[model samples]
Each structure stands twice: as C-alpha cells, then as structure tokens.
Target: MPAVDPRLLRYAKATRVFLALSVLIGAGQAVAILAQAWLLATIITDAFLHGAGLDDLSGQLALLAIALAGRALLAWVAEVIAHHASAAVKSELRMRLLHQVVRLGPRWLTGERSGELTTLATRGIDALDDYFARYLPQLVLVCFVPLIVAGRMFAADWLSATIVLVTLPLIPLFMILVGLTTKQLMARQWASLQLLAHHFLDVLSGLGTLKSFGRSRVQVATVEKLAAKQRKATLASLRIAFLSSLVLELLATLSVALVAVSVGLRLVDGRLDLQTALLVLILAPEAYLPLRLLGAHYHASAEGLGAAEQVFTVLDREIPATGTALLKANRTIELEHVMVASPDRDSPALDGLCLTIPPGRVTGVVGPSGSGKSTLLAVLLGFTRPDAGQVVVDGIDLATADLDDWRSQIAWLGQDPMLFAGTVFENIRLGRPAAAEFAVRRAAGAARVDVPLEQVIGERGNGLSAGQRRRVALARALLLDAPLLLLDEPTEGVDPDTEGELLNTLPAAFAGRTVVLVTHRPALLGLCDQVVELAPAAVAV
Candidate 1:
C-alpha cells in the first residue's frame, strides 16, 4: 500500500535497448530483402528477356550472394546483442529483487514460505528473459521493419502497397484478441506454481514430523493431487499459447497471399510493369514476417509480465517503521510502554510494559506461553515496532535512526539461527567476515562448537546435533564482537551438558558486551544480571 518506488522503473531501460537493436537489425534485414527482389527483377526482365546469357547471370548471382551474407551477418549480430543484453538485465533484476527482500527484512519473510520465495526469486524472474529477448525485440521489428518495407513498396507501386497495408493490421489485431485468453491462462499457470512451491516447502519442512506420525503417505497423496492440478494448468496455458500463435500465423499468411495475388493479377493484366510486379510480390512477405515473430513471442512474454506484477507487489509494500537513531553508547537499552502488535493489528501482544537493562549485564525475559518475550527482542532488533511508546538507546529514539545502522551495533541470535548449506566455518564467519582464523577458533571454543570447521552443516544444519547447532550459532554471535548482544533462548533445545557449559562460559564469552537474553529456563535465569517479564496484552492473542 506504499507509493510505488521509482527505482523499480529500471526494468524499462532493458526493454528500450532491446527495442533499439531490433529496429537496427530489422531495418538491415528489410534492406537486404528489398535488394534481393530488385536484383531478381533486374535479372529476369533485363537479362533473361533480352540476349544476355551465362556470364551476366553469374555476375548477378554474386551480387545476390553479397546481400544474403550481409543479412545473415546482421541477423547474427542482432541475436548476440539480444542474448547478452537479456542476461545482464536478468542478473540486475534478480539482485534488485534480493536486495529489496533483505531491506524489507525478516518481518515479511517469516510469514512467507521458503519454497514460494525461492520460486519467486528463481523461476519467476527467469520468465522475464523472453520478454526482453523475444517479444520486445521482435515487436520493434514488427513495427519499424514493416514501415520501411511498406514505404519501398509504395515507391515501387502504390497499388501493391495499399493491398499489403490493408491486410497488415489483421495479424496484430487477431493476436491481441486471442491474447486476452492467453493472459488468463498464464495467470492460472502462475497460481498453480505458487501453490506447488508452498506445498513442496511445507512437505519438506514437516517430513520428519510426518514420518514420525506415519502420515507420510497422506502427504505424498496430497502432493500428487497438487501436481496433477499444476500439470493441468500448465497444459491449458501452453494450449492457449500455441493456438494464439496459430491464429497470428494464419492472419499473416492470408495477408501475404493477398498481396501476392494482387501483384500476380496486375502482372498478367499488363497494367503493371513486370520488374515492379516481381519486386512487390517478393517484398510483401518481408513486411509481415517480423509481425508474425512478434505475435508468437508476445505469448511467451505474457507469463513474464504476470510474474513481474507479483514481484512488484513485494517491492510496493510499505516498509513499516524501523529504528533510525544510533545507540550512543554500549552500556544500556531502554523500552518505555513498548507494545508489539501483529501486522493485522487484530490482537496486540505486549501491552504498555516498560523495561530497562544496564550494559555489561545479562538479562533474562521469561513469560508463560503467548507472553511477548520474543516480541521484545524483535522490537529491540528493529524487526518489529512498538505500537504505543518508544524503544530508546542513550536518549536516541530507535524510530529516528537508520534501521540497518542501528542494528549493526548489536549481534542477535534469533530463536531459529539460520544456517546455510555450507561448512560450519562459513556459517560462523558469516557474522564477521573479516575475523581472523585465530579469533574465530577462540569464539568457537567459548561456544563449545569444537567440531572440525570443514564439516558440512547439511540442509538447515541437519548434520549437527541440536546442541551443536546452538553452539555454532552462539559462535557466530560471539565472533561479531558487537557492542550489544541479544540472545533469544540460546539453550531452549540444547542439552543439559551444553547448557551447563554455556552458563559456565557466559561471562567470558560475553565479557563487556550489553547482553539481553530471553529464556524460560530456570538455569539461564540465574545467570542474568536482571530478569523482566513482558506481561500479556489486555486482550488474548
């Protein structure tokens, strides 16, 4: 619901460049074609009709060859420019989409599915390739090439040009009419893909749970049903695309035949000169050729347009308020009547609750389930906003500073510590890319993640034990060396031994940093310098 960002209009640049190249190539192609007809007419009317023989024919053949080669070379050049330009545009678009997502931050992604997001980022953006490569490029040819060819036709003989122009609009007009149906089909196809992506990610994430409950077969059957629906939608879209192409081709073919017929009649009637009639007949098809190509590719581009519309929706979302002021010092964080609400605002979670924890101290937030312990940390990290009052640091309102700059002053371990598909070293190093090897090893030692750094974490850290994943996540936070550290239940799923070690090494691991931790565990509560409970909102969630 935010105002559309002007930055997204950058997609237009790629389209413009594509169209420009198309005009150049299309004109070059039209010239070669017109020359071919003129040369043929000269050979037929002058040489063949007169006493000229083999020698003259040989000279004309060489001229024709030169024209043919020129057209071929220009066509090849056009293709290269199109492909390279398309690739650059595709790369830039993907990077922009990713940057937009990151700027929007975790608040948006948490409610969305991973597979659907992946599909949007990967398959969705890929659809735009043909929009740039084929449709826009050929559309340029359709418009400009025809104009050039038609002008040459009128100069040669206005009657022939009139016949061709009368039928020319038939192709594009029919294409547009059929395109309405194709657009609807493409929309259905996109919806099917989104549903398929959501279903697959849900199934994969819950596979362990499904297997434990002996419900894997049910999920498999559900997937089969979804896949069948997707297949149906895909076929429907393709069928429409093919049918539309057929209609456009038919219209173009009819137009070309009409021009050929008129030229032939004029030649037979002796009303038109022989050479001019031959030229008109030959050049007529060239005028409509690019239109045919554009019509077909327009169907291909429809899917991309639909996908882009969906992507634009994300970019258009109002980036809800986040902190702007930098934390003045490392010693303290304060919240005054900070209330965290759902995006829907149907149920507010944390009420007008207030809290303060000093620097160099460990704090614990404990609450019954549905209490806003997690939301408190979220607001502090600027992932969510307080509905009523302000969250402040050293008298600077969190809402007044640049959010990303404010967040950099703190290292946070969320309830779910994200681990990519890489080695443990890379995962921990993600927090502090410039940290030296020795510094990294020491942090790992403090967090007790002593496993070999080269070991793979598997998909989502499945290769490691729960305690090991916890320790590795802790190592990432420690390696950051941030001024303020926020730990959201560092030991919730960890074992007692790992928990005891984390507790024992707590002071040294987090020495001199302001630490605010969220925990329901009694053992973790004892380690904090203070404990605060975020009371539930007046109305239950």
Candidate 2:
C-alpha cells in the first residue's frame, strides 16, 4: 500500500478535512520552529559573544519566550486535531464499511468470517490512532518543517546546509529499507490475528458440540497453537520496530554531530560568525527530527494500514441491482428456472427450478439435506439471487424491485434464530417495535410462548431451552404480521411433545399471510395448502 491511500479521502470526508487542517497547521508549525530556533540562537550569541547584559537583551529574551510558547501551543493544537481527526476518520470508515457490507447483503457475507469482520471494525480501525495521532502529523511536518529549516540553514551557511542535505536522505533511505521488512512482518502479524479471531469464535460457537463429541480438548490445543503463532508474529514485528528506531536515531545523531563539528571548526577559524554558527548548530538537528520521528511512528501505524486495505476490499464489492417499484398486497410469488450456485459446493443449490405460490396461503417446502428447500426460501427472501431465470411478484421482477420495500413485506425465522440479551417482551417486540402490549401478548399466546414478558434472557436466548427460544422466535414472527412469512425448519431441535404443540399452533398463527415453510416433518406438511418436494441440486426440479 502507499504511505497514504487516496481511497481514504474518497471514502471518508473527514480525512479530506483533516488533511486540509493539517496542511495549515503544518505551515504554522514550520514558521514557529524557525522563529524559535532563530530567536534562541540570537539570544545565546548576543549574551556569549557580545557580553550583553539582562537590560540590553530584555527585548530579545521576551521575543524568544514568545517564539517558544508559540511552538509549544502549535504542538498542542496539532495533537488535539490529530486525536479528533483520528476518531472522526475511524468512525466514518467503520460506518461506510458496515453499510457497504449490508448493501452487498447476506449472499456476499456468507463467504466471509464474521469474527474477522468484527475485528476489523473494532481493533483494526482502532490501530489508526497511532497513524493519525503521531505518524500523520509528523508526516505533514516532514513535508514542511524540514524543507523550511534546511532553507534557512542554507541561506545562513551553505557548507553546514550541504552536510544536512547530504545526510538527510540517509535516514529515509534506511527507513524505506527497514520498512520493507517491517511491512512483511506486520502483514504476518495481522493475518495471524485474523485467523486467531476466526478460530476463537468458531470454538466458542461450537463449544457444546465439541464437548458432546469429546473433542473440546483437541480444539483447545488448536487454539493454543494459533495463539502462539500470533504471539511470535507480534514479537517479530516489535523486534523489527525497535531495530528500525535504533537505526533512525543513530543516523540522525551522526548527521547532527557532523554539522556541529563543521560549524565549530568554521567559527573557530573566523569563517563564520557566532550568530550564524549558533543558528546552524541549533537548526541542524531540527532538519532531521521530523524524518526520524516519522520512521519510528511508521511501525506503530503499519497494523492500521494493513487493516484499512482489507476494509477497502470489502467496501469495493459490487452490490446487487435493486429497483424502485413498491410491492403491492395480494401478490403471487413465482420462480421460473431459478439456479443458485455456492462457492463451496460442487453443484448449484437450486437448479432450473420453477414454482409459484398464491397470495395468503401456507406452502410447505420439503427436501433432504443438500436439496434446495432453504435455497428456495432464500430466493424468495431476496437474500440469494438466481444466476439464471427470475423471481417475480405480482408481475414485478424481484431483481428489479427495491429490496428494502420487498423485505418490508417479509417476516423471516431461520432454523437458528438470533436473540439479543433482553427481556421476553423486548425480543418479541423486535418483529414489530411499535406493537402495543395487548397485541404482543396476543402473538405470544398464538405462538404458545409461555414465558413471562418481564423475564430476562441471556444473549442468543441462552437462558431458555431450545424449544422455548423457538417459541419466542415464533412469537416475534407472528408479531411481524407482514404479507409474506418465511420459516425455515421452525420445529428443528424441539422434543416430540413440543414439536406437536408447535405444529398445532403454526397453522392458525400463519393465517392471512403468504407463508413458505421449509421443513421435513410430515405433520407440518399436512398444515400447508400446497406441498412441494425439491430434489438434489444435481437434478432439475
């Protein structure tokens, strides 16, 4: 990646504004640095060489104090801007990234790791703190202060300026060489972190299954191995950072010492005056300071740079086309020759399938594992688009219909429903947030949700049993009351008694909605007005 990506400016408006302010601040800081150096040099020369007393140097002393104060104030102001800019830029990038992900939809997200994306939005974006707070500000100064300091030095004394100009490039030249290696190390460390996050999340999500299979210990060992690899990569990056810092410091110190020696010799030989010599010596180090600081902070900012590249990759995905047509009520859903492919599967999920369901009726979809039952619902829900053929609703092509408007007509309940940490009422109200208490209670009663409304539940409904959670989710779906209801294996993982009770309630709860049910139970199929069985993706349906 380039030291600064132009996409950052394009994707985040705050970055553009920050850069503009940085330029103005940088110019002011450059002027302040020169004034302070010149005033300090004049004060020292006047006092030492001309035997100037306090009264004679009072005005110069006051001017020097003001210059020093201005430089410090500018530094503080730059710091404040850097922090604020860092926060604003990070927030902007994260929001853009999340919005882009949503635009790409669940189809695109299926291929990505949730943990990795979570890390990118949180820790990955956070890494930019060093980039904005320290590295970027110094980068602006490197553009302005160094050149200004060197120009003043050249006008005062050409020989000392020549030494500074010749040695200045050495610091950056070495920094570039070290940075190449550091970049590779940082990439490895970042990759390791992402892998660790992905694996850790997987372990947590499947911990119960691992324990049931007596393989939890195996997963623990695997996690330990990944953690160790991440640790090693991090240590390697730190080692390179420390080594580069040392190299930069040594080059800068030697360059400044060379200028000091040259200036001292010329002053002793009467080739240079005390004021000019003092100015040259003081300003020599100033020329090297920005470059050295930049090299040091580059390592600190590398992790954030790597993360930004990944975020941009996600942001660059092509969003599926949508349309402006509003979906009307009493519309029929028709799928003609639909085929959906999966990257990880050999065959398509839905292949050359044609189907239709009339408005306000329950349709049951039954199939074996790996068949297109769930894929059919995904097609109707607009989460997965067909590679060939079209899904039409009331003569409007779903591909051409506005997805938000289309989805507004849908109430979906997945086999594994997600529940946040909240009370029963809050979880049920998610389907229809504006629903009154009586309406909520009616839906819960229809769905057979016996839990108390004020009873608190853990995240993912951890406090409830599988059957209770499904009932809560069903209540949510019932509360939605959208025109279309899509339920995928709602009775899955429930006991036989609970499953029969749920089946008894579903038909009445599904009344007055265009319902598509994906399931394997014969009892549930009996409740549907029409039943369709899908074959494996290898064969046409």
Candidate 3:
C-alpha cells in the first residue's frame, strides 16, 4: 500500500471526508502550538529578566491557558473523527467485499479457503482501527506541524532554524529504513495468522470425523504448531517495532538537545534576546515530534495495510459479463462447444463439449470420478461460466441472461447440502418464504422427509442423519416448483433402502421440469428419458 492508497479514498467516501477534516484539524493544531509556545516564552522572559510581578504576567498566562485548551480540544475532535471514520470505512469495505465475492460466483470460490476469507472480512478489517485512529492523524500532523514550527523557529533565530532543518530529514530517512524491515515482518505475521485461521476452521469443521477415525489428536497438534508459528511471528513484529521506536526517539531527543545547546550558547553571549532564545528552544522539539510519532504509529497500522492489500487483490478479480434477459419457460437447453477451465488441474473440466436436453424431461449425466459431472451441473446452474462456447436456452445465450432472473427459475440440490439451524418447516420454506404451511408440508412429503415439521435441527442439520439431511435439502428444492431442477448425486451416502426410496420419489418430484441429474446409479439412469455419459478426457453419449 502507498502512503495513502487512492483505492481507499475511491472505495470509501468516508475516508475522503475524514482526510479533509483532518487537514483542518492539523492546521488548527499548528496555530495552537505556535500560540502556546510564544505565550510561554513571553511569560517566562518577562517574569525572570524584567522582575515582572504575577499581576503583570497574569494576562499572558490566561491566553496561554486558552491556547492549551484549544490544542487539547482539537486533539479530542481528531480522535473522535478518526474512530467514526474507521468504523464507516470498515463497514463499506466489508459490504463491497461480500458483494464482490457473490459476483465472482462459486467457481472462483472453489479455489479459495472459506476460513481465510472469514479472517479477512472480520479480524483483518478490524485491524484498520490503528490505521485511522493512530497512524492517519499523526500523518496529518507531520504534514502541517513541522513546517509551521520550523518557520516560527527561523523567525526567532536563523542558526537554530538551520540546525533543525538539517537534522529533521534524518528522522524520516531512518524511519523509512526501519519501515522496510517492519513491513516484511508485518507481512509474515499476517500470513501466519491467516494460515492459523484457515487450519483452525478446517479442524473444527472435521472434528467429528477426526474423532471417529481416532486422529483428533493429530489435528490438535497441527493446530498447536500453527498457533505457535503465529505467536512467534507476532512477537517478532513487536520486537522490531520497539527497536524502531527507540531509534526514532533517540534521533528526536538528540536533535532537540542540539537546538537547546545552540539557543543557550547564543543567549549566554547576548547574541540572542531572552524571549527569542526561549521561543527557539521551545519550538525545536515540536518540529521533529510529528515525524517521530508517525514512525511509531506506522507499526500499529502495518497489519491493516497488509489486509487492505489482500482486499484489493480480491476486488480486482474479473467477473464475467452478464445480461438482463429472463427466461420465459422451460425450453431445450443446449451446450455449444462449452469449455470450463479448472485452476487446480491443467486440463479443462469440460473441454469443448456440446450437448442438448429436451425440455420437461429427466436427463441423467454419468461419468468417472475425475470427469466433469459436477462441473457440468455448475455450468448449467450458472455457478460456473464456460470459457468457450455458449449455454443456450431456446435461442437466448445464458451468458447474456440476467443471472439472478435466470437462477429464479432453477431449483438445485448439490452433493453436499448445507442446512442452517432452524425448524424443519422453516428450512423447507426457505425455497419460497411466502409459501403457505400446506404447500410446505406437501413439498416435504414429496421429498419423503419424515422429520416432524416443528422439530429443530442444528447447524448443517446436525440433528438429522445424512439421508434425512438430503431429503430436507431436496424438499427445499422441490418447494421452489421451478421450471428447471439440477441435482448432483442426490442419492449419495445412503443405504440401499434409502436410495431406493429416494429414486422412487424422483419421477413424480421431477414431473413437468427440465431436470439434470448427475449420478452413477443405474437405477437413477433408468428414470431418465436420455442418459449422457462423460469420459475423463471427453464428453460421450
């Protein structure tokens, strides 16, 4: 990320407003700094050298109080704005990221980890609080304060001003050098955190299976290793940050001391007035303070900058163009030399394959394990786009159709169906939320779901067996009563009796629909009007 990524300003309107406000606040703070310093110098010099009474210095002291109050007020306002701006920007980025993920579709997601993405959207984005609340305000001050302070010092004493100018650049120069190392360390720390999140989520998801296989301890050890790696990376980053902060502080302290020495020597020799020397001494440290603070806060924000970079990487991915035309009715579906590439495989999943399915008929697709059976269903269901050729409905190309409108006519059941935590009726009603109770029960009956409608299930339907979960998913799909239905191994992982029961329900369940069933069972193929077989290397009849 650059000092200020243009994408942040472009994506989050709140960032632009925050920056503009920060500039105003920085200018106010600069004025307050100069006022406070000048008032203190006048009060001290008048009281000590002129033998001024408390009454004579009272007015300067009062104005000095106002300047002090003004500076504090501005700081508070900046802090408040920084927090609000941080929240708004985070919300905007998360929403855009989610929408972009949806636009990229399931095919793009197939190559990525859900846990990594979860971490990015949640904890990763939250890290930006440091970027806004600490780093950005300091950055704004670095721009405004140093120049104003330097100019004030130059007016008071040119020799001291010259010294300040000569030494000020060194702070940022060394800061840049240290920042390079910090950036690398931060990147490593962030990568380790993401890896830990990914594997931890994977372990949790497969915990039950691991226990069944007596390998849960292996997964626990792996998670511990990942967690330890993340911890070490974090400590390493913090160590570098502390070392860099000390370096900045050392440079800033030395520069301030040098200015103090010059001002004191000039004062002793009567070359500089008491008031002028006091002002010069006071303003010297102010000139270097912002830059030193900037270096310190950069470490606090480095993780956020890294996360923003990843967010941009995902947002930059290209999605296929789509159209707005809606399908009117079930029509013959055609795949014209369709080709779909696989990121994990060198060969295309569906290579220049073409097929046609008559409307309102059950078509079975069978293939070997590595064949594109599921890929074919993904393409037909619009979750994956073909790299070559067209999927046409009647005469309209699917690529040109409004995907949402097109999907409105589709009722699909994947091999592994996801069921949210809810009553059985609620899950079935998900297909058509406005459907009446009778319609919901009818669909559930059609799919042979024996679970009580009022019975509640756990996440991913944990309360139900595999066969019951499939039936519930099938019921949800059936409830849609859509013109087209796509099922991938709907009878998979079931006993023979359960599979036969499911197969028996298919003909009536599939009635008056353009159905594409991907299964290896001969019994399922028997129910199809026409069967299409796909080879490992090609599509065949």
How much lDDT does each candidate structure score?
0.80, 0.87, 0.90
Candidate 3 residue-wise lDDT, 372-467, digit = tens:
999998898788888899899998898889888888899999878889999999998987999999999888887888889999998899889988
TM-score for every candidate vs. truth?
A: 0.92, 0.95, 0.93
Kindly list the per-residue Cα lDDT of model 1 for residues 177-199, writing each as its tens digit. 77777778888888888898899
Query: Which of the two candidates, 2 or 3, achieves a greater TM-score against the reference?
Result: 2
Q: In candidate 1, residue 531 scores what lDDT?
A: 88
Report the CA-based lDDT of candidate 1 relative to the real structure. Answer: 0.80
lDDT tens digits by residue: candidate 2, 1-541: 6777888888878877778888998888788788888888888888887899999999988988888888888889989998999999999999999998878877677788998999999999999999999998899889878889999999999999999999998988998899899889989999999999999988987788899999999999999999999999999999999988998999899999999898888889999999899888889988999999999899999999999989888887778778888876458888999988866677889888999999999889988988988778778878888999999888888888888878888899887789999999999999688999998998888777878989999888977888889988988988988889999887776777877777777778877888998988887888899998898656443
Q: Is candidate 1 or candidate 2 better by lDDT?
A: 2
Question: Which whole-number lDDT from 0 to 100 does residue 430 have in model 2?
Answer: 91
How many backbone clashes can be found in candidate 2?
0
lDDT of 2: 0.87
Clashes of each: 6, 0, 0
**Per-residue error (Å), model 3, residue 147:** 1.0
